[model samples]
Target: MKTAITAVSGQLGRAIANRLITETGKDNLIGIARTPPKANDIGIEIRKADYNNRKDFDEALKGIECLLLISSMDHPQNRIPQHRNIIEAAKARGVKKIVYTSIVGDPEKNGFSPVVKSNRQTEEDIKKSGIDWVIGRNGLYIDPDLEYIDQYIADGAIINSAGDGLCTYTSRGELAEAYAHLLTQEVHNGKTYHLVGNPISQAQLAKYINDAFNTQLTYKAISVEDFRNNRIKDLGQLVGTIIGGIYEGIREGAFNLKSDFEKAAQRPHKSVPEMIEAYKQFRD
Candidate 1:
């Protein structure tokens, strides 16, 4: 089976492509990205495609039987249209199926958060495109930037606006494995799986960081408005707004606990501690 992965340069997209190499062997998978992938040693075909242009989208889907639509990160604006262009091009090329990387919950019910609103629209666009599809509703990625937690640990303090909000965050590596599995397995084609891991509160996250590094890292929950005004002023409005929006989702229980990954795949998800451990190695 020929499979194509969009957003090949991204964290999740690159992992999916790497796993496909192991699962399917050489010459069976294709990787597409805004810029061609640089890992020439991986021994797979790499192609370039612009997410905004339908014609360039053709280069990625031309002979593929399935497509993995890893969401575009041109966020705050342009992501939905970029997704639409790719979906339409894949349909036009007669790509047999699509697997979209999305966020958890329905748009209407998850309506309060702007992040969910855009992700929901993208999910809807994929579903309506009539492609045989699988939706991987991924949770927050434990970003390497969280290594800043190391500084907080050393200083014995962390600052944040979220207060006891229960949420789940996934390692990008774990999400990649799930994405790769869905692409190769036919059974995953028609379902929506919430790709999240262990439930954690923001306070619990501080505790985890403190415990991991063997230092005191206490969280100070400030108002969102206060966080923007004082802590992140240099980040510009778009960055601050996006950060605020996600925390708002957490505040409202958007990323809270969820059912286990669908049992048929039996894939394991990674926890916050596990991700932090791996990140420590990277930081060293």
Candidate 2:
């Protein structure tokens, strides 16, 4: 079966495409990216297909049996149409099945709600597109904490608005591995799985980082308003507001959902500490 992965130049897309290659071989994989040259080194057929251009996808998705639709990072209001273009193109190209990577969060009452709602809309669109489907609602990612290690070390704390909230934080690598299975296997069709891993509080995350990097960082809970304003100051309005909204969702227990990761991936998700340790070794 020919499997095509959209947004193949991105970090998550690269991870998923590379992992799938190990199982399905390079010849069976086609990568759809907005820019093909950046990902030409990925060892697969790279097709240039922008989200806004259905004509690009029409030609790119030809002969593809399965598609892995990675959610877009565009503004929430704009994401739905962009995703639909890909979905419509995939359908037109006679793609038989599609696996979508979606997010799990509140669909209303948070700044991130719009993004969640858009993902839900795309999921519905995929379902109605007359193709067999699998949907994986991914958990909050844990990689940001590792990525912010330097800032945390300097500040002496991992500061956020999620006070004592247990987050089902899975990594991009873990999610990518799960998608590899979901995209290839016929059994995952017509199913929606919560592909999240073990839950860990922000304090526990700090502890794991401590264990991995021997950092003395601690967890500091701030008010949502304060965190939001701070992020807005640093990241500008568009991205900062989204970051604040994610924490707001976490504070409201929206991210504390049950996971079906093992069922989807057919393997136990890696523990937080184990992944941190592995990340440390990989970087060192």
Candidate 3:
């Protein structure tokens, strides 16, 4: 079975592609990226394709049985156009199966979140396209450095999330494993897997980081509006607003998966402490 992995140059995409290559051998796995993937240096197959361009997308889907759509990084508003393009391309090519990595949120109750809405639309398109599909509703990724970990530790406090509302943030590595499992198994088809790690509050997260690094870190709960207006930058208003909405939804219990997560994972979940320890080892 041939697998074509879209967005292969990205963090989560690369992880999934690498795992697939290692499992199925290099020949069965193809990497689709706007630019060449870093794995090209290690002899993995890389194909250039722009999702926005139909011809490139069609060409990328050629001879591929299963497709892994790692949602585009373009602005939230623009994501639907690309997704529609991909759906059309996939339908025309008659791909046997398609797996989408979607954001975690509920649109009915929470109004519209750009991230969640885009993926929800994509999910509907896939379902109606007559292709077997797997939806991975992934949670927040815990990237220590990107998350202003230094600022938190230095101030002895991590700011600006609601009180003790559990978010089951998954490490990139754990997400990779779950994605690989879905890609390789037929049983996972037509299933929406809530791919999350151990749930933790911001306070627990801070303490875990502190314990792992042997430094003092604390969690400070603050209003979402204040956090968005002050802390998050570089992302324009649209994306920022969407991010703020999702976090609010998370605190309101939108991202919470069922207790059956352990059953699906078939192993104990990785806690915040473990993730911090792993990060430290990588840094060292």
Q: How accurate is candidate 1 locally (lDDT)?
A: 0.74
Candidate 2 weakest lDDT stretch, 10 residues: 274-283
Relative to the true structure, candidate 2 reaches a TM of 0.98
**Candidate 2 displacement at residue 164 in angstroms:** 0.9
Q: lDDT scores for all predictions?
A: 0.74, 0.91, 0.75
lDDT of 2 at 195: 86
Counted clashes in each candidate structure: 0, 0, 0
How far residue 230's Cα lies from its native spot in candidate 2, in Å, is: 0.4
Sorted by lDDT, highest first, which candidate order results?
Answer: 2, 3, 1
In candidate 3 the C-alpha lDDT for residue 138 amounts to 81
As for candidate 2, its clashing pairs are none
Span of ten consecutive residues with least summed lDDT in model 1: 105-114
Better of 2 and 3 by TM-score: 2
State the lDDT of candidate 3 residue by residue for 50-163, as single tens digits: 878878888888888898999988876778889888878888888899999887767654433666787888888888889999988887778743257777766778776456
Clash pairs, model 3 backbone: none
Cα distance off (Å), candidate 2, residue 63: 0.6
Top candidate on lDDT is 2
Ranking by TM-score: 2, 3, 1
